[model samples]
Target: MKKKIVALTAIAVLSVGTAAQAAASSVHTVQSGDTLWSISKDNNVSVEELQAWNELDSTLIYPSQDLKVEDKVETYVVVKGDSLYKIATKHNISVDDLMNWNNISSDLIFPGEEFVLQGTKASTTNKTAQKATAPVSAPASAPVQKAPSAPVAVKAPASSTAGKEMTVTATAYTAYCAGCSGTTATGIDLRANPNQKVIAVDPSVIPLGSRVWVEGYGEAIAGDTGGAIKGNIIDLFMENKQDALNWGRQTVTIKILD
Candidate 1:
């Protein structure tokens, strides 16, 4: 009876050890050219969740990073000329959110970097999807004409229920034309900077948290405004004097989309 008791105890210990091992070894395979964005899209997971799961500093990933969780992660093959930013936009998510999801600290992603996306594919990418698709007003034959010049003396939009003050959080990187003394930046240069956080918002018209779909630029939440950008005015950031001049002031209609 003593021997049988000892044997049973040993078996119990072994079973517990097996269970612990299983809990610790939820591994995921790496595929060719897999990026965190693609994997997140396929698996229906946010890039943020993936990052938390793996404790990544940036979006950088390598082949065959073993995931310890039993949750399902989707995978995608990387194509040549792919970028993390573009991939994030394509999936309708912010770059920062994607980075956080994958526990990544850098923007570098190579082919076959496996990542786990959380949730059903549809819900994860819906927020970043473009809301306004109205064709930009331009000349009949010219290649996208400039917006109409700002009214000489800008008139404020109709006043709503006594200007209520509300707090808004940063949903995405918003553009600003704060530097009025320099040339404006082109589209490519405008969207490249990561440090720029200045947002050009029209206060009375767009209340806080109201998502504003800019004409030339993509979607941006109405988060903040500059001293000079009060009322109907907007100040978009420019790289240099040349860019500002090139993208001269135009009448851009701010569509309040959600």
Candidate 2:
């Protein structure tokens, strides 16, 4: 009887230990080139859940970092052009209610930040997934023909990056042009650095804020957009008209960096 009791106790302890080990295995190690969306998909978890568990401020992650893949919680992603008031209004809740729920002391919120939204988590998950897998837009056409001194911009050549790229013509524009506002589609103010290496790309072709290398243009950000800069077309920002003219119309390779 004594031997049997000891054996049973040992079995109970072993089972509990195994359960704990199984729980710990829920963690996932981050790998190179892993985006939050990709990580969530692989783990069968949602991006909001990952953000909540890890308290992540942005979607950015580094290799060797560990992330929680289980224990999901309800959450919402704040997209671009969102304000507390705007979000509250869209959710049919009051701004004060939002602040209370999020434990936020101010009205400030940023893109990629997750919040615990009340009600209908399923809807939130679907919406988040849609955004994560949204297709890249086709490259824009050549920038509008401006003065002779303006740089001719063209679309960068295609590469094997996740986001597709296409060769298109390009034109150069100055942020300080007459009656022009220097704001980018991604909210970068070109007036702050007129000489900054930035390109106005259609948000669908190249995501805003993506770091890209323009052939002969060095490294530049796909930050701004132009009315004529649709479908494989891009407008490179130049410091002056003379520099723009010097760069008029050239085929170049665009490589999206990881």
Candidate 3:
């Protein structure tokens, strides 16, 4: 009976150890020549999963940077003054995922509400499969055009009313900038459409979603905003980082066209 009791105790201890090991978080340290794709492949996880877990805005990673690779279900209770974006940033997850996991269409959330942080593997797999099988085609309503190699000189729509004209200090920016998610404030995917004519401006000065004509950079949609872009400051979007570097900083005239 004593031997049997000792054996049972050992089994119980082993079970607890196994459970703890399964629940432990996994991390991967970036090495030279390491890419998110390679790391995700090696870890049997998707690249999106890695990005969500690490809260990476871009695919860029550096040597010795630690990344969370494990996907574990977590529940978060909303506190006072909590927003979806805030909660998502805090948990290193995407706002879209947060809404999808909780089946909420709107961003509105009340205090004490619970939200799932991680998506189920089966759902992710299904999405991947669906994407793989879907047909790829641009919408006929809005035809796709090849973007110009350089900013082209264009006039604003003749029908639209001209708004305020201001001479602002302008700087260039790219989608690959550090901590940049390649997404604009108005939901323009810069990384996917690098050649899209867009610029960041202070919405108070130049309203967002307005067409603006930059003195030298041609006409672009004022579709983005930045923390540093305040008052008389604007940021031009460039497809190439070298082009952005070449632009540097300059004072330019901009006319907002509605």
The best candidate in terms of lDDT: 3
Pairwise lDDT winner, candidates 1 and 3:
3
Order the candidates by TM-score, highest first — what do you get? 3, 2, 1
Clashes of each: 40, 25, 0
Q: Write the per-residue lDDT of candidate 2 for residues 154-194, one digit (tens) a residue.
A: 22212334233457677777776765666655444567767
Residue-level lDDT for 256 in candidate 3: 66
Q: Deviation in angstroms for 85 in model 2? A: 52
Per-residue accuracy of model 1 over 23-140 as CA lDDT, tens digit each: 4334445444444433443343334555678897765666555532323323232222335565565667655555544544545554323332432321222122121322122122
Candidate 3, residue 111: CA error in Å? 54
Each candidate's root-mean-square deviation in Å?
Answer: 22.3, 24.0, 22.2
Structure candidate 3, residue pairs in collision: none
* lDDT of the candidates, in the order given: 0.38, 0.52, 0.59
